[model samples]
Target: MADTEPEKTAPQEHVHTSTDYPEGAQVEIPQGWMYRSRKLGPITFPWYASPQSQLVLVAFVCFLCPGMFNALGGLGGGGQVTAYVGDASNTALYSTFALVGFFAGTITNALGIRIALSFGGIGYCIYTSSYLCFDHTQNFGYSVFAGFFLGICAGVLWCAQGAIMMSYPPEHQKGRYIAVFWGIFNMGGVIGALIPLGQNIHTTSNSTVTDGTYIGFIVLTFLGACLAWTLCDAKKVIRSDGTRVILMQHPTWKSEFIGLWETLISDPWIICLWPMFFASNWFYTYQFNDVNLAQFNTRTRSLNNVLYWFFQIVGAVLSSFILDFPGMRRTTRAKVVWCSLVVLTFAIWGGGYAFQTTYTRAEVNKGANTPLDPSDDYVKMDWTSHGYIGPMFLFIFYGVYDAAWQTSIYWFMGATTNNSRKLANFAGFYKGIQSAGAAIIWRLDGLDAPPPYMNIFASCWALLAGGLIIAAPVLLMKIKDTVSVEEDVKFTDESVDDVVAHKIGHEAVDQEKV
Candidate 1:
């Protein structure tokens, strides 16, 4: 059997100075059974074991898992009658997500990415089921409890995802890969949103989603878990150009923690981006509950949810082109994105502020002092009502803003390192901090005297502007054209230095110390 296998050959190195390496670099096809099984006459189908294939695999997994989760979340109040249960559930979910996410990489390294991912998928299933249980029994505690457990699972799963996404692609292709993954992941949201929109199309009253929607989410989420097991190990994944994806040998709990600590202390610039991380998921509460649920009836919320996720795909793809444009220098691209986000944040949030002034929770929900005049046209906004187009578009813009904001952050993190082990830690830190902010905001929203709607809107705007401002110096001055060999060698052991240094041409090896 061994003698019949195709012969393997040494892959020649193709060197370039910038992050974008030239296409068509020669690669010797591997002799392994997995690679050979995928071959045809002139073209090899996407081999299950290849990095590109694995990326596609992971993207689908996310599309099923978190993507579906996003759809449910985007339904405003998790498709519940009122926002309280959803708010409390999110508070529980993000609270534990913060703590576990910070150390999730350790679990990923110890158990391997597949196990972590499988564990991650479990949480979504439980969470959606809890909502189903709530629909039947009116037992909201189960939902909050499910949220707490899911948070832990999500931390590990997302950390694994970030490491794989950020490290799998060659330097210049990172942005494209992020966009592709994001587009697919958010598609889950689009499709999931459709489930509710179609099911409740006739529902004009304020109400919770039917049990069938939750069941659909649970089944899709379970399939994502099955997909997780199919992912090729990081070490075995070969890139299209036949370069080995970078990995640390013999990973252990001790080594993973040590590397995490070193990454934090050595790369102090990451601290500057904490505010940005904190602000990333902080606005979801306001967007979903305060705005969408507050303004629209059940059926209309479902329709708005679909548009939101669809625009997310649009925003992710658009940002990728700007970030990965072949003509511009990588550093120049970073600066341009920073400037654009600053402007976009102000413009979008300024519009959000204006929208918030028109209706308070009292006015929209028809609480005290709110007369239910038939001609008021301010309460219980339905999709068919007059003046619906403007608010709908504004909500869509918010979706785009979310996708671009998240894509830029991932791109920034990927710019700093190529080592998967080190990147795992970086990703963990990002999720942890982001979850921390989310937890605080979600908890606040659940409070009896929660901040006024305008105050919440204003805080989101202020934090976003401030986070971007804080991140500007690092984006402009610190990001390099490519990852330095020294940073890789210094963070990981010396074993990776030669391989990494050679992959990123010797001329560019020491260009940046980060």
Candidate 2:
């Protein structure tokens, strides 16, 4: 019995080798699991490594393109009012533009990601450049045409860019990435505003148009081309084994569009978050119109431009760091958003009221000799008195709020999707909502008698703020991590040489058993 107990089977050994399977062969195992092997090419790092960086660069180019166009508007000021389609009212111009934008933007949204991004860039450059062809001699029809083209271009570009930004990186990193992305992107406003300050050497009398503006457009267009190329070249890595699996080609629109919509609507957080983002865009558009208000002030075009740039820069810089504070860092996304909404309301609506009141009071005390009319339908400021303080504070406040809103939206997107293509399409849909809303508001402002400027501002602020607050809890409730089945895979250097490698080590013994 003791001799029988000493008997033992020969030791068992399992040997694994790379050549165990032929190149490009498919491997199948028990329980319906399958693996494939293919050699992976060298990984090429994109110009912008992370999605945040890609988004920021894209946003930056977007901001710059508009800045040049907007700078033209800044230079025109209140003195040279161009009629669009026989409608001289600024509200009408904005309204007509918005109406066209809504339709075109919606179509763009439906086009999904790849088509939208590609066509959007090409159309944007073509349409934006067309603005340079206009002269004072042109009929209102040209203005309408310009507006139509501009609206379409802007609508498409924004929708595409937003979707692209949403598609990048880990969920937790979304906040930080978006904050940096938007902060840098919005800083383009400062860059755009500064161009006018430097180029203002040619007075209005020298030429109806400034030559520098043409040069600026060229530069902006070139930058856009560079950004588009970078975006197209961005690297996507799928971690398999302990190594990264590089996906070299861009995603197809057909494969991703429906999936993106499904992911967006399926999530509880995104449903609530979408409307809030829509509100954020409306407010951002309103900020651009502040130039209209500023025109009424005695400040020179150069001075106003300087102020605009200064405040934007300060605001963007400050907001970048402020949102990272530990107390603010991990705060519920809803609360952070609500806080930003409050600040935005105060800065845009409340600040506008305060400034108007200040101007009105000054005008009355001065016996109306100041040429300042509180009832006027123009934007005015006392540049000498404030020396950019008013606009600075206003922009800084806007920058802070805008940064927060962008961060929350991106974070929400990252949490909801594993596919970047889907992120890009959803970004399009979300931004389309923004452009559509802005177009309507802008047009309505054009239609109002005396434009009820103050009342309109107040009303928009109230509605947006109320909407955000009410939606906050619902938006952030039960923020959960998305299901990423790909996370279970691991990759090593040897495995990186091949697209597919499967093995179970001592560490994976328990995992495999389970």
Candidate 3:
């Protein structure tokens, strides 16, 4: 609920309800559709999870297969996910994610978030279960089966997530809500890491993961799918103030594309951020799944993931506090995100050192069955890898780094834009590009050593470059243009019918211009 009374305001519905909007005009949405405004400067960090965050959390937990076990599934049969059938599926996943995401607003608008969530959830179920069966049957068919659906699901669910994240919370709490939403759902990574540790603890090495382990993934996958069924669509969402947000855009295909084109042309940030956003997930996938998981021993890898999730939560929570820290200006808050993400990029490369610490060596070989030499600098195992202490500590630290980088992206995207429909489009665009990045690496999985050979530092730096690219364009643009002055004013001095009408998106206004 708005903390203050509804001041006399312009009919916000007029933004959307205007029959005169040109083709592809962005309709104004209910206030409930926008994120809550903060009294303080730019960031919206809450100390605790809001009840409203359950949607993101539930969606995330159900997303276990995509980021969690399936990512690890590559470790099966010596990085089967990257090296063999999974390579094809991984490409399909992102390609589909990008393709579907370009126009996912239509899907959500037509079918609603529930169906998209369910479809995405079911995709996870199929992908997770199919991967297990493929591994069991050595069938290429199931691998392809899983990737296609997962890609489509990623496109749909992500758009839904963006809509809900921006809309469900109040302005002040939006940042915090995003933090909690992401922090909780990321627990899937922790759970995924733990499951393999338990299932494969007795195994000789990172050989074929046990059938029972696949069964575990299957069960967890379905549990997540069930949760998806329970999720509500964004339009129907009940906001904090107990008002139901009416349905926004149910754009026709042509209108959606036109709107998307208009947005891309008008918003410089969207164009600049696209490359980085597209490649975002790929770096992590290659580093953690293809490289780290491929190289480490079972116990060490397991311990690494334990650290990954545990510290990730800490990082996410702590980073949120940084966002909400009292007295910080909006620029300072953004800088915090930028600097942290940049530093974390180095930390990703630091994984090489961590990988070196393990006694396991490159458990998987490069093509031609090249010997995985523990003594060679390339395959050399480090004391950190050898010792549980080093691996655990790194995971914890990486968690914070991961938390800072990942959560910042979500919050940053929402904070900058108040357009619920555009926000959904942004989310879809981000994920679609992310899929493209992942797909590139899936192709290299079959190789003995994926691109840039052994220079993990370079790889991490590349990811940092992407993060920097994402931040650079936004910061370079004048602060006022990106963060509407009127929107900021609404935080404290809410006037009757004046500030908010201008503060929120004006696609309908754009339509007038058109």
Candidate 4:
């Protein structure tokens, strides 16, 4: 595990036939238009079967689901007239999400990625529809129920998403693949935010989003659910290098449960990641409710939401360049990202503190000092306000910090292993722990005397700083230059099928060539 030692690596085998594949394995490359290469003159389109293409598909899957979900979150109070119901719903959602996500990996392996992902896509429609119901009737219970149901579905959906996004790419391409996925996924946020910005363009008062907005979300999420069935099975996927993706035999229910425990024990260092995961979602309530909603009009909040997610794309792109910088050692890349995150965390949160000092949620609620109408004055910063640019830029930086933080975590997990099965479990644990922390914070945010905005800002800064500190030892000592097939094979119950053997000699290409 030391940084200087040679990392474990699988030996190369130059195979030339299907029979050469390890026995009892149907590891043949998938045959279909999507899986076949087409040459139109000199240009050859990459096969849809390629890892890069599959990763792009998976990214769109999230773009339609969680990407829209992020848009709703960014709208503050889920685009409702008040934050109370939204806060209550998120508390219920994360509570169930924490419990279900911990076991979703076992469910994913037993069900297979495609089936698990299909079920995962179903909950967003339900969650989005509940908001529509809330719009018609003042029923908080419906939103809470929808949130709880979506949490269960989200648990499975995200674990499946993480498995594909993390396990599909070659070692060096992990960061770029993650950035690609993040960019596409957050595009859902960007477009989803536009729905309300355009709808509420002339309305400056605090009010609920129209039925048209909720209906659009429901339709998009439903389509995203249907796309899950199109994903290639994990075992049949071949990398650009003609090596098969790493996956073991189909898992039995009992074996999956056992693998979950093994995933933890086999790599105890994963515990170091728990804190960072816990802190991952901790800032949402503060950024969404406290800053964007409390200080901006309805249309302005929508505009800021657009900018927030847009900058997230920018942030993901920048981090990928640093983390996947060519010819750098994986550990050195890890250190570089870590240092950058630490510096940004301090600088951005410090700005957040200064902004927090300028206004209190209580003052915003009562319309104490603003010159505008009481209905609209709960917000101080407006799209037309003279000093609006300062606070707007602060919120934008928050988005950038968020993307960088999340991309680094995914890259770290991908660096940790290449096995789809193990990566699935790792993804589940990450969501579980992350939701557990989110549940607590959301509950706190919903309280009668929710912690002061200042307290929320300080806690976010402390948790982020502390998480980096806790993660240092693992980054310094445990991360390897590369993951090997043998290490992944030991984590699962079955040995690797060595499915890389195949007579696709002409298709084999260097990683750079791809």
Candidate 5:
């Protein structure tokens, strides 16, 4: 042929024969299949690589245990508060316990995932189970000790579980995962409320004193232990002696602690998230306290619990689904947060009005010397006339709003950040800030003042709402899209083959990386 160059020898295709593979290699579908699929892109929908069965099981167990425990604590707190009243020593003791929990969380954060989780679960089981021994006759010393131990356990459990959940799911899937887990967990609160209600009902039926509430705690503790075992089994490699030994090495220990500190201080996203998380905590704690306020106004403990459980279920379910909508996803995390804050403002204002009305009516009733029927609904100041409809509506609104905000924030955090170490550290810092906020609220309560409950509640809510509103715009402006790791790494035909080969060659490595 006129200018035909020597026949180009077909490029000799050299197969990659070396056994060595890139660290943390994952199996990927063939390029042909991926190219054919419309959704094949960097930010893969459904975030996680096909749901990890073991992880999902472990997560379910984790959710159940904490949910039950927290719910029980909510119920038990009222009784403990009543029992320890006017005991200055007990107040000091509660404070000390809370302080210990604060420190324990910091330590857990420094320890990394494996060690922290193992220790945390075991510790929680032991301390939480001890609740069975508590009673009205127990002195302030006992109450303090119980509270202290429980606090330590709770702190560790919270920190460890949070790290585990965040570590497992990719960023985009975080909202859905968190919402499902949290909804299940909050169900424990419902169960907890229900247990007491059941006990109350039984006591009413049998004409006996309400003495079997502790039984619920015992049952929950056992369930928690079983779940703890599952968690332990799920990650056997990390539990091995070799891993433990390596972690104890002085250099490793120092590196981990330093890394934790650095992560807390340097992360910009985490810094922005702290205030919002703090507000969330305040709102949650406030809700817990509202049960007592409801009881006081309605003079029926059963009504309070029933209303709470009802609203919590509704709110949790609604929030879970609503957050998944495209418009409300990661990009609108701040907007969700702001909406919660605004709703909280109205809720608290409504609560204050209710309180003021109750106070005025109480004074009138006291002056008149009439024997008040606790269950009477027609009293002008009775917020319970509608069976806590006012407070219930408020709680329902807050719960839904809170759920959406939490889902958005956590999802955004997990998706946007690539570093797992940093995510764990940020979680610790965020929780610590939450504890600090709770402490501030606790201190601000003028317990000695003349029924300043309404003022205290109103002021805190107003301030929290205002702070969130102010910060919302700033956070919204800073919000950005998440970058997918898959997108950044190019995938060619050969690369796809390599990935598939790697998975076949080393199943263990693929599992570990995923």
Candidate 6:
């Protein structure tokens, strides 16, 4: 029996290196798909097959659809959620974002990427469509349900997206891949940001959005769902070139949780990142969403989003290249990450400064003191709200901050471990904590508008500061003396393809004998 038995297959091993490889050198890419390049002129670079490239391209396109919808959805709050739902319903719409974010990750782990992203996208499509009914209804129930649904969708989508973005790229070129991924991700933000600009959202002081804007958002939201399917299925293990490595079957739920918890408890550095993970999304303006809309004016709101995304896309793309320059060392990227705290600090404190300096006492007082209603336009825009310049700076610098932290953290995780699936679990943990923090912020924001004089933005400086306190010490210890590192790229089409084929052959022989 022992002699007759088939030989067992070996586990796949991932290889990484720190030796600097020259940029654009011919490296072994594991992909099996190709794309035509039109960069030269009317003609093209012949189709180069690489499945990995296709995944990245599809992911980018998918991101834009949801990003645009998300941008437009921001307008729904503060009495604009719908005419009949009223200002109070803003709580339901805004808070759900935090509520479902992390939980979605667990579900993703259970359902795999395709279900997580597809349903999440579908959820957005429904949520966006529901906005069409906002003007026609007064029950508020539908609005609440839609908001909850969207929140759940957002949570899962972000979790799956983060996992894929971080894990799928080859070890050697993760920085550039991340940059392109995030750049495309935010490009959607830019498009969505511009949508509101056309609505001339600034023309009136009332909390209102144009119908055309709603139509655009709905169509775009559905389109994102369509593209969601174009990405690689999570049920398969895919290599850098988008070639299938192996079919991934579901593990028992018990083992999954056990593994997830083991990964979390075993890593102190990751645990350190947890607090800030929660704090990261906590600083946003939703707590003041309705009031700010009234006090600052729609132009300020729309333009801020537009401006935020523009610099963010640029920053995200550039940071990717800078972090991975030919001669750049790990120490350099580490330094940028450490420096991010300064921007983080300034960005945090700057929000309050902008709020205080931009508007008059009367405008601040009115937005804060008055009862919010769809028709109320008591608060006015201070053209001098150059104070928004603060967030603009933040949007720009935070772009750097986001680029640094997100890219660095993912890179750090990969550098620390060879297990891509394990890395995803870690991502889930981080995202879960992040969502919890965001949800808490939303929950609080929905409950009460921060005091008019307190600069709701000002009060949270402590939470972020506290988060940094935990994050900085751990990160510095881990990266304080980083060295330059790079992946020595190696791959060949037939050789790489043969590995998978060989494994399939073994499995086939075993099956045939059985």
Q: Rate the local accuracy (lDDT) of all candidates.
A: 0.82, 0.45, 0.56, 0.82, 0.45, 0.53
Tens-digit per-residue lDDT, 375-462, candidate 2: 2333344444455576556544545555555565555555554344444445555655555555565555334232434555565577
> Each prediction's TM-score against the native?
0.88, 0.67, 0.74, 0.88, 0.68, 0.74
Which model, 4 or 6, shows the larger TM-score? Answer: 4
Ten residues in a row with the worst lDDT in model 5? Answer: 239-248
RMSD of each: 6.9, 10.4, 10.1, 8.8, 10.0, 9.1
| Model 2 vs. true fold: TM | 0.67
> What does candidate 3's lDDT look like per residue over 294-332, in tens digits?
556555566566666667678878877866665676556
Evaluate residue 423 in candidate 6 and report its C-alpha lDDT on the 0 to 100 scale: 58
lDDT of 6 by residue, 309-383 (tens): 677677667667655666756646656655765566676456546645654434533434333343343545543
Tens digit of lDDT per residue, candidate 4, span 1-514? 6579788754443323333234543323333342233321222233765788888888888899898999988998899866778888889889999998889999998898788877878898889998899777868789999889989999999999898989888788889999999999999999999999999998887777889999999999999999988877776567754456666566788988988998888888999989999999999988998888788878999999999999999999999999899978999999999999999999999888888899876777674332112344444566898988888899899999999999999898888888888899999999999999888888888786688888888888999999999999988988898766567677655444453624332333212111
**What's model 5's lDDT at 458?**
63
Superposed by TM-score, candidate 5 places the C-alpha of residue 93 at a distance from the truth, in angstroms, of 8.6
Higher-TM-score candidate of 3 and 4: 4
Where is model 1 poorest over a 10-residue stretch in terms of lDDT?
505-514
- Ranked by lDDT, the better of candidates 1 and 6 is 1
List the lowest-lDDT window of 10 residues for candidate 3: 505-514
Model 4 whole-model lDDT (C-alpha atoms)? 0.82
